[model samples]
Target chain A: MTMKRLINLKRTEARRIFITYSAVVIAYVIFQVMSSSGFLSSSMRGMLVPICAYMVMAVSLNLVVGISGELSLGHAGFMSIGAFSGVASAILMQSTITNAPVRLALAMIVGAIFAAIAGFLIGIPVLRLKGDYLAIVTLAFGEIIKSILNNFYFGVDAQGLHFSMLTDTTRLLKGGRLIIRGPMGISGIMKIATFPMGFILVMISLMVVFNLVNSRSGRAFMAIRDDRIAAESIGLDITKYKMMAFVTSAALAGAAGALFAMNYSTIVANKFDFNTSILILVFVVLGGQGNMLGSIIAAAALTVLPEKLRGFSDYRMLLYAIILIVTMLGTNNAEIREFFTKLNPFRRKEEA
Target chain B: MTKRIFTCALLILAMSSCAFGAPFKLGGTAPLTGGAAIYGTAARNGAAIAVEEINAKGGDIQFELRYEDDTHDAEKAVNAYNALKDWGMQLSLGSVTSKPCEATAAENFSDRIFALTPSASSAAVTEGKDNVFQMCFVDPNQGTASAQYIGEKGFAKKVAVIWKNDDVYSKGVYDTFIEAAPKYGLNIVSDTTFADGNDTDFSVQLTDAKDKGAELVFLPMYYQPASLILAQAQAMGYAPKWFGIDGMDGILTMEGFDKSLAEGVMLLTPFNADAKDELTVKFVAKYKEKHGEIPNQFAADGYDCVYAYYQALTQAKANADMSAEELCTKMIEQFTTMTFNGVTGENVKWSANGEVTKDPKGMVIKNGAYVGLD
Candidate 1:
């Protein structure tokens, strides 16, 4: 009976999950190949980490922006919270703590908590505001987080050691550490991240987001996105679902942020500026507003494009902007979408 | 999620701490793979070369070099630092950009993690932190050289300041040019600015300078700005003894600017690859063999920085399993008289402030290629 039920699962449901996951895995492999190739510029190779990190970011964001039908602009803020929490957790393990993995694990958890807290705080105020307002509130939250990071100070070191008078248990953050050295940033960290590590994290985050998005909750979220009034009329409990999506995405952003902070061995306040948030938006929007595979592709493509065009240097950005406009315009037209949709067998089956 | 990562980190840290004890683990954090990977890549390669040479020497202590890519972002620099610390690395080299440099200069990586940045020259790095050490010349030094050369040439009485305003590197150079050019008794009649790192053609700024009757203009910027400004200035026929900073080293070699129009442009470079010195000859040859091009300040800084880190490590591990703190202090002792015939020139002992107390050189763009004017 169980085997028969598994077999009887809707074709689209199984295909949606498999196709999305397979595409991500393949894209990352391609990215790895391109990064190792001799022709790929060194700058682009370095950008892969962010591409990896942002893939996680975009996917988690999709939980809110796409799957849940909510517009969030303050993802960078959650990332900031995750960074501080992760730094604090990592630093605590460094000084008083003995286990590296344990410290990192705890830091990741702490980062999620911080992100969840930040999400809740911002969600109540802005989630209620009608369309586009949520984005503005989230934008403000990102700025506020940056400002807080810039101004906050940790305790003075007794040993005058680089260790910010920060111990992981009591201290919310280690202000004086070399990695997230408060505003200027914490500098000079070791590389714990590789393609494998980044890919693993991205996969885990994607799986979690996918599970949440494909559930009954996910459909309700999508319903709201398509029409919030209709969803509420259908008794979808809009606020509860909105909060759920917001919190889930915040946690994922926090997770990615924590990993990113550890990846750099330094964290600076300015990096979480509005621009970083906007870049994530670009990834999600470029990929296809609600399309996970599209986001992953766009993220990987955009990350590597500038490197391929390094000879152009400053003009590379001009070319990228132009490409973005052209691609968006082309895809917005039904004829172009129809043309591409009919070309791929798998997608054609799904479309039919 | 945090619990899982913390568990793994603890497991790794425990293993690394036990495994890597006593050996000098030299690590670096730089933007090795990102938009600024060019800077970090050169730095990583240079560090690689130095680590190999030092390890090959086979001293009392063994050395392991671990490199972290910061992707030119400050947040990532912290992550790299944590990983190095977990690995029991006492001393580190790198952090190529001003943001990370400034972050460290604010007295972040001290005592436990000693740093000697190969590239960070922002004034902010040196302003506050005593632990942060820099090996390269500052933007002001480049600015001073240009201003002094222009003053010596008797180019013009009025000097103009035209540069990108929010760019820390260019602005640092511009401030130095304006302050020093006036100190040399030259009047700067016009000061013009542009937007972020994108502003190119300087026709408006050049015209303003020309209208202000400025005879010499100090354009301290990167290759993009240099290319646009030089071309536009030539078009406007506003040739006022074009002087520029060191950003013109590599990019100028293949730049499409009307070189014939820029016949008499003077540069106050610390050292040009085209110099006739034996060091320059050897460096340029090796650099071309390895990188297929001459070494710019970025490349030279990368090479010098790795060697400098090796020198410190070698001194620390001369006889004992000492900590990085002990090694860094001992480094200062050896630095008093240490001299390396760097790719640029004979760089002598470093000042306590990390500045290498040495004289620079003048390079003239004669026949379109940069050549040291003796």
Candidate 2:
């Protein structure tokens, strides 16, 4: 009986992964066909890359909030680090890297590395706190990152890259290009991010998250999340697992940031703020904790919902708030949950 | 046979509808529900009034304006721009703020849509976008104009500058003001800077300006920080001739602000609501009746943008059926060559680089109202 139950669990996991992957692939194919055949509106076409980026963000954040059971309010901070560093590296490589895809890939990798380092550093002290304390500290860290980027000035000249704080382009030599102008941010960026690249990034993020969640380290993370005392009694290094999940999440968020930043011609530090962090958290919560496929759907749907309500004019945001409230309430309603379960054909087969 | 006849009738109806005219679709994005909602709401209202009047005029040209809220965010502004594109917008008001305008202006340039922003003063909005134009003075233009006015009018010789360093609008004006001050023979006594999260107190900055024996203090920031500085200066008993740019225009209407503190303060703006000109009077009356408040410079800028577009569209003989790309080309040609007279200015013209050529009027606040300085 135990062997049969184990097999059943593995089968369910495999099916979940297959369904998620197929959903992404099918959605991509449908969108591509629609866009090429002029069936998709320009608005929907513009949102494709951002939707993919947000899906990655939601999944990575779910690793920390859902799997690791640590509420992080500074996800956008790591993203900002990734975005600025990626932009800087891309601008620096403009002459050497003529191919847009190669340049964008290298930039995203650089961004991921920087974000991972930042995550490791912040996670060391941040992991000591629990619950609300961790959330507050992360919030402060996010604000600190935003303030730093606001005063950060970077430029590249014949003398190489110039970095400064609290000073404008006057420090840079003449004829040098200012890549990041303090609060003005980086403008005139070549939009190199494509929907296909976004898809690949999302897939990579999903694989990392899924594989990590199924690994021994992921079990240790869940063990700590369920009961820290019991996890510690089992000789588990709580700090190590927590830090592992955090750094990995941060790195993925950084890659998503790079993808998101490259889709726009201009980007500013203000794009990633405390509000953005909360937005990703909302995606995780509404999608259901520990549910990867749900995160992708929630991210895409929420991102498109606002644009879809444009016809409502001034009442757009109000209607959005109402819809969100109703969704939250409905998800929590036991009757609604049972109804959804009844609607699932797979569940029916299991019951039979 | 009946179904075929019905289908033929529907096709003919569609073709006839296409043959006739419809209102030209105009779209804009604004911060209608955020920190800068005042400016955005005012601009939207001002544009709506213009659209209503034009449509009521029963002329060859009519406008259908649609505005989406961006909450003063660049990302949301791009999304709003896309929605407008999907709605078949042929013309745009870019955005109501500088950062968002900069983002949307890039889209306008790439998509070949003509844009005229109401109050995005940042030069970056029109820097490399020939298709994007400003209805207000560019930041550098405002800075130089302020210096020239102060120098020629002999307002004060010793001036101290306090600006927000982290704001592109403030920094842009400050950079140009510093460059032009020397040409006007104005002596700079002190200079100070502040950033976003540190703008609450102004005691330190005011002390420096006061210690330097400055006769005039130049503030190149929005009304929020300016109000704080004004209150702080009054508390410290450091009174100087306060000079401000167009960003200071709304201080009087700010909630919880002491109106007495703003007496004798001067600002450089393109529009004066108190002007007795026929256009100004009519617009002010209409705006007051609709918005229930005095119209700010942003409202005038929005009003002038529509009128300028109206003049251009009339000159080009543009019809509603033209594609946005075709309209863009025509707008580029017409704006570059045509002269416009509106509530904001007389004989306003745009250069090829999308900068407007208009005179900045200096007005001083007296008895809780703006009075013409000249």
Please provide, for model 1 over A1-352, each residue's C-alpha lDDT reduced to its tens digit, 9 standing for 90 to 100: 1345335557676676678888778867877788677544434555566677788788888777777766777788888888777776566567777665566666777888889998888888878876787778778888778766654444334434343321122233345443343344444433344666668777887777766776678778888888988998989988888888899889878877877776654466667788888888888888877788777778777766654554453465678789889988887889998888788777744456
Error of 2 at B202 (Å): 3.7
Q: In candidate 2, what are the lDDT values of residues A149-213, reduced to their tens digit?
A: 88888888888888888777446678889899887888888889898899999989988998888
Candidate 2 stretches with Cα past 4 Å from truth are A1-9, B1-20, B186-190, B211-214
- Tell me the spans in candidate 1 whose CA falls farther than 4 Å from its real position: A1-64, A67-224, A228-275, A282-352, B1-26, B32-35, B44-68, B80-91, B104-111, B140-149, B200-203, B253-265, B307-322, B336-341, B345-347
Candidate number of the best DockQ: 2
Native contacts kept, each candidate: 0.09, 0.58
What lDDT tens digits, residue by residue, belong to model 1 across residues B1-374? 99999999999998666553345677777776545666676666665655565556655455677777556666456445544555566666747777766644442344435677777776556554445667767667767767777777677788887876535567667767776877677898988877432376677898899899888777776566666777788778787866776655544444365666556666665667787767567656766787675566666776676666556555545433766677656765666547765664575456666665556667667776677766
Q: Can you tell me the CAPRI class of model 1?
A: incorrect
Against the true two-chain complex, what DockQ does each candidate achieve? Answer: 0.06, 0.51
Computed on alpha carbons, the lDDT of every model, listed in order, comes to 0.68, 0.90
